[model samples]
Target: MMERTALISVNDLNIDVALRQAALGDRVLDLTPKGFDLLLFLAMNRGLVFNRKQLLEKVWGYDYAGDTRTVDVHIRWLRKKIEADPGKPKRILTVRSVGYKLEG
Candidate 1:
């Protein structure tokens, strides 16, 4: 198995994969299991857009039967937690008519 980095940094945010933790500066951000997974996925594949279907499959798994709207909801939740201003997100960006990607 390929070795994985224990920690990932996106801008000022810090993610510790082994502990499944996310922090910003001196504050540790509380993220739900799926929310952390979503953030990790995007942080891992920064700049690469993944449509709702792809996000659902990758994050929620192939066995998941939820609709694409689930991804939207999760993204909204994530932005609220991570973004300085959720209304104009700078990290998780929406690719119109396409998908979403993380930018640090």
Candidate 2:
């Protein structure tokens, strides 16, 4: 039997990640495909730090040839949609020069 995956919610922000549906809430936001994938990756591994390269390989596919800035851009986009204050993000956070971690 195949196990089913349920939605993952970050209740503090009233956000839900519907993995099978590839959506953030009751409806999908205007996030790009990559943005959704990036958010999904972080949400699935909440609180775990992942560097740009790791994210690219895991989320964007190992054959992806983009630079780390791509990850930054997607993270920025995610913040805008999910954060109450994008400037002072309370969810996804930077680790100086290391990378990022998702925290609710």
lDDT of 1 by residue, 7-104 (tens): 99988989999999999897898899999999999999999999999999999999998688999999999999988999999999999999999998
Give TM per candidate: 0.93, 0.79
List ranges where model 1 is wrong by over 4 Å. Answer: 1-5
Worst 10 residues of 1 by lDDT: 2-11
Alpha-carbon RMSD to native, per candidate = 3.0, 3.3
Q: Each model's number of backbone clashes?
A: 0, 0
lDDT of 2 by residue, 29-97 (tens): 677767767877787888889999999999999899868788888899888887779999888899887
Candidate 1's TM-score reads 0.93
Q: Candidate 1, overall lDDT?
A: 0.94
Which stretches in model 2 have alpha-carbon errors above 4 Å? 1-5, 12-28
